[model samples]
Every structure is written in C-alpha cells, then in structure tokens.
Target: MQYINPQLDIEQLGRAFQRDGRLLIRDFFEPAVVEALSRAVDEIDWALTYRDVNGDRVLSGEQLRSLSAEQRAMLVDGINLVASQEFQFSFCTDSLVAAAKRGESHLLARFMRWMADEEFLASIRRITGVTDINRVYAQATMYTRGNFLVVHDDHVDAENRRLAYVINLTRNWRADWGGLLHFTGPQGDVLESYFPHFNSLSLFRVPQQHFVSYVPPFAQGERTAITGWLIAA
Candidate 1:
C-alpha cells in the first residue's frame, strides 16, 4: 500500500495479463480510497485456522469441543494426514465476510465497497479482459512459521471465479524464508513462483494449480497478504 496517489497504466497491465496469463505487479494495489481500512488492519482479530474437510471454517475452543469426536478427528487429524501428501493448508486468517455485510461507515465494509467499485473493477476488467467481472471476495491471510498450503486448483461450482489475487503487505521477507507462491505444471513441475514481496500484487487465472510454500521455522517475519478472487458473478 505504498502508492497513495501514483498513476497506474491500466492498459499496460492489461496487456501483461493477456500475454502471460498471470502477472505480478510490483507496488500496485494501494487504493487511496481504502487507506483507512489498511490503517486499521492491525486491529483485526485473526483466526488460527486450517481448512477443514467440510469447508472454510474458523473454530473457537468451545466450538471445537462441541463437535462430535469423529467430526473433530477428521477435521484435525484426518486433514493433517491429508497434508502429508494431498491438498491442505494452515494459517491465520480473518475473512471479511461479516465485515462486508456491515454499513459503509465500517472500515472493512468501506474496503469491500472499494473492491467492488466500478472504477476499481474497471481496472480489473482491463487487465483480464473479462468484462463479466461483477464483484469480489477478500480475506486477510498471514503465514507464520510452519504455515503452508499444498497444491490445489481454485474451483467451486456457481462461484464463477475469474481470477485469484494476492496483495502482499509484509516487508523485509527473505527468499530462503520460504512461503513463496508456486504454480505447477501437469507433471507437477514448478512452472513459476513468486516470493511474498512486500507491496506487490499477484494475479492468475482461476482454476489454476497453485500453492503457497511452507514457511520454515527459522523464518524471520510473518508473510501477510490480502487474497481473494475476482468473480464473473
């Protein structure tokens, strides 16, 4: 969020997204309209979370206890077991679902509004050349030591996701510290990768094979980003 008032050449970005099918725009996406919400990010209540077999969830201790033993075991042990090979993730998150429902006076609500603003959406349309984009969903994600996401293609019927985006906010991250975003090829070869560079915007077409590399225990700082999708709606 460094550039508060700098001009961005949307047409040029659009060309890049067109030619590459994915792009990493350095120091982009700092919307002055959402400056207040960006400032309030430190106050967010983070959920120490993992994606359960059921779906996206954030469980409290009492809530975890309330679940049946079988369910809880599957969500925790079973899912972790899957992580040994298959797709799974563990990280801190604060999905802005509830905040998006509030009035615009709320900082997060205003941020959500800004995301769906015609001016902003227009920029996205120009980039991807997918004019159907109507709205988007966003969540704050933080990867601390040991946090990881195994490879998976983002897809869900009726969601109509056009592309996925991640805006990194962390500073001074080292390359060897891990937590890089990696895209895979058909035979599981790494086609491309991007470190969680501070103040950068990453985008790729939806339903693409991608994963966040595991953060090693020796990682010096948190890997933080605002990630979400631009949807066709």
Candidate 2:
C-alpha cells in the first residue's frame, strides 16, 4: 500500500514544527494504507519484555521465563518498571533498497522500506526542515495494561537523530484508558498531551522531554504504534 501524502502542506507543517518543536498531523496516512498497516502489525510476533527505570530493556522472552511466578509478579508491579511487547528493526542507509533487491516480501519490512525510500525521506525533510536524514530506525511497539515509559530526552549523539516520529495505529482509545503522549515543560509540568488517534502522525524535534503515559489496567485493547527516528548520515 502506498503511504505517501501528496497533498501534505509542507509550509504549514514546517511552521508548526518551528513554533513548538512538535507537530501532530491528523489522518496522516490514507485509510487503505492505515488499514493494511494495522493488519500487518497485528500479524507480527512480539517479544514480552521488561524495561528498567532508565527505559532500557532489562529482561525479555526466555529471560522472563526463568523468573519464578512471585518474582515476575513483583517486577511487573514494581515502581519504575515498564512491561511491554515490541519488535524493533534498524535499516542502514541502503538496507531497505538492498532488501528489496533480494526479493524480501514481508509486509512490515516493505512498509519500512517505503518509509526509508528517498522520496519519503525528502517529504519528511520538507516537513521537519531536517535535511541530513539518511537512516531510519523503526519499531513496532505494543503497550498493554501496566506498560509505561518515564519522561526522558531522546538524545544519543552517535545516532545523530533529528526528529522523532510516532505513527499511531490503534483506534477507539479513551482518555481514561491512558497511553497518551505527554510532553513536559522545563519545570516538569505537562505542556501538552496527545491521544493515540488512528492514522495520525506525531513528530517532534529530538532531545525533547516526552513520554508515553502508562496504559491503565482496565484498558481493553492494546496501544500499538510504529515509532522511529530520522537520523543524519
């Protein structure tokens, strides 16, 4: 499915980014493309993992199986712990094109390739006003009950990341169910919050304080999204 938005207003998008260092584009992907991407996300296998207080993956898959039931329960209920299901993929500058050349046919891989395409990168550059992007690091994240990420600035000098993007795939999310993307000011107060609206795209300048609020225990559905960073060459 083609995901490009030919009618995107580059000037307006740039102005929004310039104003707040962030922009939320509603109905960013076409309905058909969003449907296809959502189905593809549902079909993938995700690893159950635990993230530490620093938001780093601490335990995953078989490692969790090693823990006793009581220990596992304690870890899940502990403060500063984040439990989630996710799959991450990284593409070098030319890996996407190389994968296509080798006849790679996975739906999610193809979607990533589309995102890594020069045309798509150019479009993102126009929107964010970051022109050095040459690599795309993408992940499929699933946040269920009790999952959360603490506030942090995504700053890794080696990655040279310019923009952070999250393409929300879940629908019918409620404010009470949580999983909102909250951005905080310098004083640690919430400056803005965004829902995981279906087919919407959220982009922000890197090294900004932000986080995904915890998914409430009563949330009946999973909060899923394709999230990634656009990095310089």
Candidate 3:
C-alpha cells in the first residue's frame, strides 16, 4: 500500500463509517504502539494453520490452529476463540483471559479495550449505523498472520452480533503477498479490497458477503490483525 496519509481523525473516520456502512481508516494507531505490536508479533507463535475450503492447508505466521484440549474447549464455550468458517483463531490470549476472569489485566484485554476505545467505537457505530451499540453482542478476538477467513458474512439471524471490525497490525504489506480483506456488496460487485497496513482499521456492516483471499505471503512473512464483532451490550 502507498503512503496516503499519516493521520486519521476520529470524527472523519466515524462519519465515513456511518455513510458507507464501512470505512477504512489509515494510521489509526499511534506509531509507537504499531512498532511495539510488530515486535510483539515476532515474540508470539503463529505457526499453526488449517485446511481452507479448497482443502489446501492454509498457513500463516500470525495464526495457528488450536493445539490443546483447552484451546478447543475455549472455542466451543464462547470464552476463548469464536467460530469462523470451520475454525477459531486466538482472540485474547490465555493469560489475558485468566487475568480478566481473576479480576486483573492481561495484554490481550488491553488490546481489546484499545480497539474499542471511545473514538474507535464511535467510528464503528457511525459506519454500522448501530444504535445502542453498548448492547454489543459477541466479540471474536484473535491475531492472524497468514490464516485466511473463508468468504462469508457475520451471523445475520444470530440474535446478538451486528458488525465486524477488523484492525490491521502488520506493516508494509503488498497485494500480491496476499492477506487482503475483500468485500462483496449485495449487488455482487467486489466493493473493497483492503490492504493489510499497519494501524489501519476496516469496519463493515454485518452480513456483507466477504472473504480473505489465500494469496501467498512474501517468503512466509506475517499479515497480522485482530477481528471481532460488536453485539448488544
């Protein structure tokens, strides 16, 4: 992605989301934080993968398949991972969940609140036109490197979630290296192809048909991001 702007005002980003039901905000995170996250990604293990719909083993340095019985249990119990396609990636980490459950702060918990900060949520609500969003339903939190999210929409009839907010954490990404978030409008037109750039935010209305392409990465590099939804509070 080319350098367009270095700043993203909350008000402008919020309005964009409200009008289009989706918006991409570039440079949404502080530069230092972005650098810290990139370093952190290097420290985390993201070597896990799963077979995509095409029966191909989807590999990523930012995501991995659940390894332990506890991890799988977390996915099924609505505490750790949330269901997407046929798998669940990490949202908040185990330590984070443990801390919150024990009334303490975890790294993952801090990240979640940062993404849902006042200005950020305002931008999301404006984009999604979601009223009383505090009624936020389910939030699927996780990190991914090259793991692909199969083409689909958020649960429409599932009475809780209403929107999907995908925030990019990787820096210096390219189109051919894969990890692009593609969206299809109701009319069947490809509406958006958001590149994976550091500190960028992509907010879309619930149930809009979309898919993450399986394009290979640049020599096994990572395309990291955190994804989840806002449900009724």
Candidate 4:
C-alpha cells in the first residue's frame, strides 16, 4: 500500500530542510492510508506516560485505577511538584519499537517493519541527507487537555538518534488550541512553532531545543501523532 502521498515534491522539501533545521509537509500521507492508521490509533491501548520527581513513569489504566486514593494523590502531587520547577510531561504512548523488537504481527508492528524498510527510510534520507539512518523507532502519542511536554534537547549520546519526526494525525487542530510543537532559541524565546496539521509530516534535527506546548483545559480534542527518531547505529 502507498502510505505516502505521491504528489509530494521531495526535492522542494529537501531544499526547505537544508535551509532550515526543520520542516513540516502538509498532506504528506495518502488519505486511505491515514484512515487505516487513524483507526489503529483509536484501537490501541495507551499507557499514561509522565514524569515525576522519581523520573519517567508509565501507568496503564488498570494500574492507575488500582491505586488507593492517598497513593494516587501522592503521585499527582509528585508530578505537580516536578512540573512547577523542572522538566515534566503527561500523555499517552504505545511503542511500535517495542512491538517490532518482540516480533509481533500486529498492524502497528507491521507498520514499523515497513518504516525500517529501505523503501521508507530512503525517502527520509533523501529529505534529510543523513544516509546513515539504518533504522527507526516510533511510538504513538495522544496529548489531551492539561497534558504537556517541557523543553528538552534530544541530546542523549547513547541513543544514536540522528533526526526526530512526528507524523501528525490529528485533524483540524487549531493554533490557539495549544498542542503546537515549539522550537525555542538559546535565550528561551519562541523561534518557530508548528500546528499539528492532519496527515502532515514534521522532521527536525536531533539535539534541537523543542517541546510540545501545553494543552489547556479549553482545548477541544486530543492531539495525536506518530513520533520517533531516525537511528544511525
């Protein structure tokens, strides 16, 4: 199946990427392919992903519901405290990376398999001009009201991350709704921000200072995306 829209001008996209460190291509995916991908996202179980004073945390729905009132309150307090002063976030995530690693035959796993294939990676290479990207790691994300991600440079040296990407699946996301991907300057000023365009593909170099802006209570719907990195190992 052709997941990518054949109408894309890849050469133009490459020029944009070279001129800037990042680029967002709208209507990047084929409509039929996007429908299937969206359906898969709707069906997958998502674990609550967040950060607290204890660091990264992933709580399944069942596990969260099982916590005693006081335990749950404590967890909330811990996350809030960390959010007040340091890096923190809360969202839903399911890893395609894990599925593929385990040899799963599910649709998401097959999608990951296709992504790691040369046919897909070659297109990414053509755009980014980073030929060593031999593999990919992807995860589904759902950012709802009050969920957020604080700024962080994707600089972990051991991860072999070359470029980061987000395949935005949320339809009709407004800029004012605030689930935007924001890039900041060294002085912490907003350099550029991108709305989550439906069926769009966003690509940015690694080690970039960026974050998903907070989704406020007034936002209408959840922001969904397939996010990951091109690996060079």
Best by TM-score: 4
- Candidate 4: global Cα-lDDT? 0.88
| Candidate 4 structure quality by residue, lDDT tens digits, 1-233 | 78788999999999999899799999988898788888888887778899866678899978877899999778767877898899888888999999999999988889889999988899999998888999898999999877788899887868989999999889878887788999999999999988898888989999899999888879998899899999899
Model 4 clash pairs?
none
- Which lDDT value does model 4 have at 153? 81
RMSD over all Cα atoms, model 4:
1.6
Best-to-worst lDDT order: 4, 1, 2, 3
Candidate 4 or 1, higher lDDT: 4
Give the lowest summed-lDDT range of ten residues in model 3: 89-98
Q: Pick the candidate with the highest lDDT.
A: 4
lDDT of 2 by residue, 82-153 (tens): 333332211111123444556689777787878888877888888887888988877777787777776777
List pairs with backbone clashes in candidate 2. none
* Model 2 misplacement above 4 A: 52-55, 58-71, 77-104
Estimate, for each residue in 177-210, the C-alpha lDDT of model 3 and write its tens digit: 6668889877877788888777777877776788
Clashes of each: 0, 0, 19, 0
Instruction: Report the candidate with higher TM-score, 2 versus 3.
Output: 2
Q: What's the TM for model 3? A: 0.65
- Distance from true position, residue 80, model 1, in Å? 3.1
lDDT of each: 0.77, 0.75, 0.57, 0.88
